[model samples]
Target: MDVEALNALMRSEFSQVANDFIVQSVAPMEAVVRMPVAEEHLRPGGTISGPTMFALADVSMYLVVLAMIGPVTLAVTTNCSIDFMRKPTAGVDLIASARIHKLGRSLAVGDVLIHSEGMDAPVARASLTYAIPPRST
Candidate 1:
C-alpha cells in the first residue's frame, strides 16, 4: 500500500488515533510518517513524550511493512528497542522515517529515525521487529 491506502487503513482499522498520524510517503521497503504534535502528546515539561514517540516509531514501521506486503493487519510488533537522543522542539511535527533492513516470510526487522520538524538530527531512534502472520495458502 501507498500513502493514501495506508492512511485509509489506519482510519478504518484504528480510527481512534488515525488523526494523529499521516502517512507521508512510501516506497519499496521504506515509509515516512508524520505526527502532528498536540498538547496531549506533551509531557509536563512541554516536550514530546517518550511513549508518544515510541508509538510513532511503531506505527511507522507497521506502515512500512504494510506498504511492502499489502493490507495484512495481523502483522504485529514483537520487539522494539528505542533510544531517546534529545528533547523534541516544543511544538512541531514529528517525522518518522523507517527502513526495513530484513524482510522474511514471518518476520521483518527495521529501524526508524524520528526527527523534530525542522531539526537536523533525530530526537529518537528505534529498532523494531514485527511478526507477520502466516499467509493463507
Candidate 2:
C-alpha cells in the first residue's frame, strides 16, 4: 500500500506511544526502524538492552506483515525467537531491517537483522510468526 494509507492505519491502530517507538521508513515487505539509545534502554555494561532490541524486532515484523496485508490491527504475534549476538554501541540508533519470509492466509513469517548505526555486523537477529486475521466477505 501507499505511504499515506500506511501512516493513517498506524495512527489509528497503534497508540502514539507505540508509534513513537519506531519510525516507519518503509512499509510491508521491507522497513527500517530506528531505536534511540537512552538511559532507560541501557544495560549493566552501558550497552543497549535486550528488551529494547526485542521491541525493535517485534515492531519491524509487525510493519512488514501489515505492509503486505494492509493494516490488520488484529494481527498478533504467535511466535518469536531472538538471538542477541553482540553488544550494541552506546548513544547510537539501532536499525532493524525486516522482511517477510512467507505470507499465508492465516499466518505471516518475518526475519529481522538489527544493527547499530554504522556497525558492519548485526547485533541481533530474530524470526517471528504472526497470526493474520481472516478476511471478511
- Using lDDT as the measure, which candidate wins? 1
| Runs with alpha carbons beyond 4 Å of true place in candidate 2 | none
**Where in model 1 is the C-alpha error above 4 Å?**
none
List the pairs of residues colliding in candidate 2.
28-67
Model 2 lDDT per residue over 11-92, tens place: 7776654554465577547877777677788888889988889988998788778777877878899999999999899889
- By TM-score, the best candidate is 1
Candidate 2, which ten residues in sequence have the lowest lDDT sum?
15-24
Error of 2 at 83 (Å): 0.6
Name every residue pair that clashes in candidate 1.
none
Question: RMSD to the native, candidate 2?
Answer: 1.9
Model 2 TM: 0.88
How accurate locally, in lDDT, is each candidate?
0.96, 0.82
